[model samples]
Target: MAAPIFSLAFALLLRLTYATAQVDPALISRACEYAKGGPTCVAWLQDNEDDAELSGIDRSDPDSIAFFSLKKIEKEAVTVSEAVSAKLSAGTTEDLSPATQQGLAECKDHYVPAVDLIKEGVDSLAGKAYPDAMKFLRTSTLDLIACQKSLAKLRTDKKDTEADVHATDAINRRDLLASHVALAQSILEFAASGGGAAAASVAAPPS
Candidate 1:
């Protein structure tokens, strides 16, 4: 249970500033492929596979494809976070948004510590002893959502202030870093639950 969280933490630590960072088209397609399963996850995989085929076709510029792919990944993360948080809070679809700041507000106790800790890393979080990190991780989906808004607003602001896309890409880079941190906490919370344990246990040598 704790191992996954720890693993994610380590991954994010290595990622440093690129937490929610967007990947190339090929990576996005690959992630979607892994998510697809039978009726539940598989349908997604097939769709993503199809999407991958069209990846480069949609772009005259390479950055367009990267931006589009990044959007897809961020959107998917938002969708999953919303679904899980809604399940936890018994809320509705109105709760989730990439451009809004609702997810964290609605579920802050459950996710902020993880968010902060991931941002800060394991040596900083201090393991299971730190309940706040767990709470933060639970709400990481929300942070990702808020990050989207920050980046969007920053873009608009940048247009009024300067010529560099630096303000925009810099914001995105920050969000990506936060996303990675949240992902670490999410992986931990998921692994700690009975469901995670069972799943992990199954992939190991028989007792």
Candidate 2:
């Protein structure tokens, strides 16, 4: 009976260890540490371990991980853009201030370019052109920052609680994109040099 109990405990421990070994929590956390989502971003990556975009990916390869991260951010940008566009298109705008409405409109205008830049980065990654990928990511980062600034200006002009809520959500979305781009840049650097030079290059991603 004692031998059987010990065996059972060992089996459970092995299973736990196997599960923990499957995903690198530290990698996810470090990758998303700069984003607004923070821990939530890490959780998102963990939850999406089985995503088709990441299928059969070698998690140990920095390039592969960066590609996967870029694809994820691209999807997120698409989703957010679509949602905001639909809201502005079909939803009533009479309740919003002119500043808020204008800001949202500007965001909609930039969404296409933003997604395009990310897609370009994805293509660059696929082609093994890490520097090109980083450039595209940087361009998208700037676009997101511009969108956030637009919303920030809008927020200052209006004190409506509802607009404030919308602004907060929009800012968070921008931050997530920015974080993912930065992570992708870092991953590329790590892949290129393995250590020292990678750290210096990624310490300041283009703008």
Error of 2 at 57 (Å): 4.6
The TM-score measured for candidate 1 stands at 0.30
Q: Which candidate gets the maximum lDDT versus the true structure? A: 2
* lDDT of each residue in 1-207, candidate 2, tens digit only: 445544653453345345432455665555555333476666666555455544433344455456557767888888667655543543244356566677778887787898998877766666656677778877887778777766566443445455455556666777776676676666656554442234455332354
Residue 190 shift from truth in candidate 1, angstroms: 5.5
Error of 1 at 48 (Å): 29
Q: Report how far off residue 156 is in candidate 2 (Å).
A: 11
Model 2 weakest 10-residue run by lDDT:
195-204
Count clashing pairs, candidate 2: 0
What's the lDDT for residue 206 in model 2?
55
